[model samples]
Target: MKNGPLFFFGLFAALTLSWAGTVLLSHHQLGGLAPFYDENESAAFPLRQPGVAARGQLVYADLGCASCHTQQVRRPEFGADQAHGWGERQSVARDYIFQARPQLGALRVGPDLANLGGRKPAYDSDDLISLLYTGVIPGAKAVTHPYYKFLFDERPVVGEKSAVALKLTGALAASAGSQIVPTERAQSLVAFLLSLNNSYDYPEARPFVEKTEKKEGEKK
Candidate 1:
């Protein structure tokens, strides 16, 4: 090969082509993705997040919750995510079409929350609020998670205790006359977590099933 002007021109063209194919091509393909509508359900899948939940998403990002948790679920064959009850089906691009900023985390220190609200015996608002305030799941002792007690406020019982006050006891108790209640930010954050459900089945999200050879004794 000669170290000539033609060789340098060819190299520049190759780099430009590769960059266009990888970056521009992908944006053209998926940049305008829209929500999947379900005729049977009479609504669009991945419904838009409510105003409070949307604000909570900002709080979630600010707190760096994505550092420990992921919002994407892998295919069953690729990982034990399905077996672990993280999600029923693999996540698809349409699942995040309504999100302002999707939190597709890299680490798996905590469970994937892609289908948290759609999980079997789903985590209700109270459950999430309790977890945020207390740091641990109801009965699980060994599994200690981060506690966001700062999200709550201790206030004197003005007329009656707030309906949303945390039922504190033992060391986590508030002062004698004050009640602990979650702030608006905390409520919004919990609302956002509860809105995370990717149970809707998209055609592209279906897992690829490979054919297997059957033994002589096996029935067809």
Candidate 2:
């Protein structure tokens, strides 16, 4: 009986040491990952947030989006990073260090979102938001995904909402037809999605030293 207890204790100790070692190694490696470029010139790099992204991240988790869409991107060989137009290089740990509880999702039920910021026009946040809430583009003939229109506000206003299209964002309400309205929740989620830009792929954004030479006409 004493031998049994000792053997179990040794096993437990080994497991604990293994887990602790894994944690230490991961922290050392990931915590030290380098930034892709200097913050000033690289628009693709993560920019300063006004404490909104974290709240949006909470919305993302509540919506159960991680179950379908993955935020982490492996190299091209592992998946359709090239074919699906995610990015040229694999996602590194540095991309997500700012997030308190980083979401490195496991499954690929939907396209990866590691690099989605510039994929559409700068104003396409509404489009994505609408799609997320209603599962279809407005005026589109058909849609395959389930409708999340229930998250939006369907009531029409008296004259107009915001001229800047802040009207585009509000609580979603289910509509009879396939009307795609972006909800407040969906808008926040899109805000979080649009925040995931990584600069290393684009050459212009990469840090480099430029050289200049005096012209022949103006030589000293």
Candidate 3:
């Protein structure tokens, strides 16, 4: 009561300083970031997303996919992201300058997808669709991905099976004379998921490699 005005002013100042430290400082550091151009490759890193993939990124957000999966890869020393084959290098602020609303999620309910597009033995689009439809592929180990069946449609076969109809077996197969097909939104979402590659080795992303001294007279 006696010092109410001063107490309120101190609280307000503290909140303003905190906001400036986090938001304003970050913006000043990263707001003007530009793509890293490689002379040998003659191109820039982190290409812009295709139209469909951009739409799909929105779909990914709308479906709350970030709640389970993260798009960021932790440093090797910080975690086992490299060992898990999620990414070869740690993600950096440059990796996300092109992303309108970067989904740098905080949990790892599923695999990190920052480099999914560049994964070796890359995921087949059909396989990804099936995984999205059923949350698991045939004979694969248990999958934690939630089923996104709402993205597909089960409809009676018209003249012939639609070209886009999914190939299904087991109980997931549609009833006789019926087919399961991915909607345009489903396709877009998959496009976004596949576009989540952050494989470009930005200088900032590269890990610090400490040079070790060889033991005396060990070898030349």
What candidate 3 gets wrong by more than 4 Å, as runs, is 137-143, 209-220
> Compared with the true structure, what per-residue lDDT tens digits does model 2 show for residues 192-214?
87777763453332223364563
Q: Model 1, poorest ten-residue lDDT window?
A: 211-220
Model 3's C-alpha root-mean-square deviation from the true structure amounts to: 4.8
Q: Candidate 2: give the clashing pairs.
A: 151-172, 152-171, 152-172, 152-173, 153-171, 153-172, 153-173
CA RMSD, predictions in order: 5.5, 7.5, 4.8
Candidate 3 lowest-lDDT run of ten: 211-220
Scored by lDDT, model 1 comes in at 0.87
Query: Candidate 2 clash total?
Result: 7
lDDT for every model? 0.87, 0.62, 0.85
Encode model 3's per-residue lDDT on 83-165: one tens digit a residue.
99988888898888877778888788788888888887687678789899988854596765678899999899999899989
Better model by lDDT: candidate 1 vs candidate 3: 1
- Best of the candidates, lDDT: 1
Candidate 2 minimal-lDDT segment of 10 residues: 162-171
TM match of model 2 to true structure: 0.71
